[model samples]
Target: MKIEIWSDVMCPFCYIGKNNFEKALEKLPFKDEVEVEWKSFQLDPTLHPDETKTTFEYFKEKKGVPETQARQMIGQVSQMGKNSGIEFNFENAIITNTFSAHKLLHLAKKYNIADKMEEALFIAHFIDGKNVGNIDTLIALAESLGIDKNGAQQALTSEEFNDDVQKDFSEAKNHGISGVPFFILNGKYSVSGAQPVEFFTGALQQTYDETVSPLKSLSGNENSCDADGCSI
Candidate 1:
């Protein structure tokens, strides 16, 4: 079975959904048969690398919400993240463009370390509060994950993966995906957002069964992020 996930590094729910999906996949007998691909999607493409702000400020401005509401929304996500063993430090998170980070992900895919690159990027943005948009930061992240430093740097500098990233965007549009952390299983079934482990386990079982049997239904909720904002 093949699983293609469309997500952005900056989306909190993407990290949460990844963890949930991983936990569910681990319990399956056919885990080894599953090929997971991480596709890039940017929730805030208009952001600039040079522009820096804390997540609180970014949320306030982007949603035109008051400070209390912004903090409350972030608190909800932070609490939800804890359920998946993630420690989200929204206070220190730096808001910036993720185009370069997505480019690095394509480079990581070449080396079969795209999963590690995705996790490292999530940790850098949500936990360590690193500027993922910076070239040095992305190069260092790629190197830390065993990708060749010069190769990663050259890819980013030369925009080698720009088309790959754009292709992901186009695919998302075709699929009517306006949110991060969208999962496509075997190119048939999909589950949106950071659903519980049980939901993923059930979906996986149904999808897997459908491979040998007939098609079945998959159910889940959508707690995803898009251009407007994240759903609470």
Candidate 2:
């Protein structure tokens, strides 16, 4: 089974959803045969890379809500993260463009380490509160993953994986996905949002049965005759 996840590095729900999805996979018998691909999506593509603002301020400004309301919303999401076993320190999280981070992810995809890169980015942005938009931060992450530092830097600084990142965005738009943490299982079934682990487990089980199972009979075979025998 192939699972494609469209997510943003800075999106808190994306991180939580990833954890839930992985847990669901662990419950499956064919977990080892499952292939996962991380697709890039920016929640704030128009935001400047150099612009530094705390997540609270960004939410307050973008949503035109009171600071109190913004914090309340963030608090809810933080609790959700906790439920998913993710410590989201939105207080220290900086709001910055993630295009460069997405580029670095594409570079990691070449080496089949994109999943690790995605997790590192999530930890950096949500827990460690590092500026994922920073080139140096991305380079350090790639280096930590045993990826070539120079290549990672080059990919971030240049337009090397720009197309691949943009293609993901285009694909999302074409698929009518207007949100983060969208999961497409086997390219046929999709689950939106940071749903519960049970939701993912059910989807995985159903999709696996529908696709991998050998037969899908409309009616019972009790009245039918086969080469071996017929029903009495």
Query: Candidate 2: which stretches are off by over 4 Å?
Result: 216-232
The TM-scores of all predictions, comma-separated, are 0.90, 0.93
User: Which residue pairs in candidate 1 collide?
Assistant: none
- Please provide, for model 1 over 1-232, each residue's C-alpha lDDT reduced to its tens digit, 9 standing for 90 to 100: 9999999998999999999999999999989989999998999989877888788788778868888998888899999999999999998899999999999999988899899999999999999999999999999998898888899889999968899999999999999999989999998899999999999999998889888455554744377678988876
Which tens-of-lDDT digit does each residue in 127-206 have in candidate 2? 89899999999999999999988888788889889999999999999999999899999978999999999999999999
Could you tell me the lDDT of residue 92 within candidate 2?
A: 92
Error of 1 at 32 (Å): 0.5
Colliding residue pairs in candidate 2:
none
Per TM-score, the best of the predicted structures is 2
Q: Report model 1's TM-score to 2 decimal places.
A: 0.90
